[model samples]
Target: MRAVIFGASGLLGRSVVCAFNDMAVTGTCFSRTAGGLVTVDATSADDIERLLSRDQPDVVVNCVGERRPEVWAETPAQARGRNVEAARLIAEGACRYGVRLLHISSDYVFDGKAAPYRPDSLPNPLNAYGRWKLLAEHAVRAACPDAAILRLPVLYGSAQFAAETNLTKIARQVSAGVPMEMDDVCVRYPTHADEAAEVCRRLAGALLRGQRQGAVAHWGAEQGLTKYQMAQLIARRFSLSAGHIRAGEADAASGDRPVDCRLDCHDLPAALGPLRRWLFHTEFPPVVEPWLLPARPVSS
Candidate 1:
């Protein structure tokens, strides 16, 4: 099968590329980049159409979206453009070409008010980031009823975290000797990028083979943990002092975020089989402290 991945250079996109089993994996990256990879901006429908027509892929998995949790407050418009508008263009192109779309979404779509959200639950996004992601999901579904919107939770990995607040970033700050603050309250399910990519490959492959993932599909790991606990795991993984990872108001501002944002994969399980089994069967090794650590404490 032929697969064309948009944003093929990003963390999730890279993993999806790796998951393909010599499946004629064509790719599209944005301009202003030269990496021997095809350049096509997902924000432009014309660009998407041009590439889709050229590649004629059987499946189109979209991983093109920006994530600037640190700078969201200053650049709300840009954030919306990246998270929302990009989804619209891809969905439109997929409908035009009659290609199956696997639109990668996020756990951020929920307000964190509810834990273990089912696929059918109505979304109430509290933050701007969450709202934008929800916008994308809606656009994708409306554009192509056949598309699968695979929503997962906080992503963590040596590769993804390294690009977006992995141990290296944490160590750089902690080694500088500034006290690191973490929220004990905020909890999430952190899925490794490679694992998530594998899940996508499995789910998309099944769908291509005429399998159903139910009405709404979810993809994530089997368990969830708190940010405070996550930090301890990270500390262990790198031999850093968990003592330096402080808790309390000064560092625990993110406690204001809705407490339980974890997703329930029961239906996803019924549709895709046991996530734990899939995770163990794969060759990917888990880190000593593999929990998803909060990037920064939420403000009260």
Candidate 2:
């Protein structure tokens, strides 16, 4: 199958690309080292249309969107342009080209007051990031009904951690003996990019085979943990003291954010015949410790 992945240089996108390595995969990187790959600005509709038309892919995976809460808050318009408008263009191009679209969404679509959100749960986002993502979902659905939307939780991997504060990022801080404070108030189901990538490939394949994923399908671990818990796990993994990492809450000082956005794992299991989970997440701080360790030169 011919597949085109937007924002392929990012962690989740890269993972998806790796998952579909056997297939003909084309990637879109923005302002990052292309390494002999296609580079496209995700926010530009003309660029997106040209690429989609040029490739005429059998499947298009959108991993491009504004994920930073700060960016969403600071520049709401730009965030919407990147996250929502960009999605609209992609869906349009997909519909025009008669291709399946697998867009990566976020758990932040919920208000977080709820503990576990089902795929059909009504989304009432508290922050701008969530709001924009929800809008993007709507735009995609409107443009392409068969588009499979996969709502994910916070993702972490060796490929991309500098932009987001995932387990590995916090682990790096603790590894360096740098004290860190994690938000305990915001409950989340942290997912590894590899896990999400697997699900993406499965769903995309299903979609290509004429199986619809309904309006949306969520893929995440059942267990939910806070940033504090992740930090503690990291500390234990590296044999560092967890005391330095204290519990935190994102109050007014931290800007608007939901308290919890743990997604229900039932829909994925029901639709996709049992959701696949990462052993690293369940066994965290250990199964993933080696990957989080600082990189060094290999001996000749």
lDDT of 2 by residue, 151-216 (tens): 998887654444354666667666555566668767667777888999998888889888864459
Report lDDT per candidate. Answer: 0.71, 0.78
Which pairs clash (backbone N, Cα, C closer than 3 Å) in model 1?
161-166, 253-298, 253-299, 254-297, 254-298
- lDDT of model number 1: 0.71
lDDT measured at residue 198 in model 1 versus the true structure, 0 to 100: 83
Off by over 4 Å in 2: 160-165, 176-180, 251-255, 281-300
Which candidate has the top score in lDDT?
2
For the record, the alpha-carbon RMSD of candidate 1 to the native fold, in angstroms, is 5.7
70-147 in candidate 1: lDDT tens per residue? 657788877787788889988888889888888888787777776778887778877778888899988888888888
**Range of the 10 consecutive residues with the lowest summed lDDT in candidate 1:** 280-289
lDDT of 1 at 127: 74
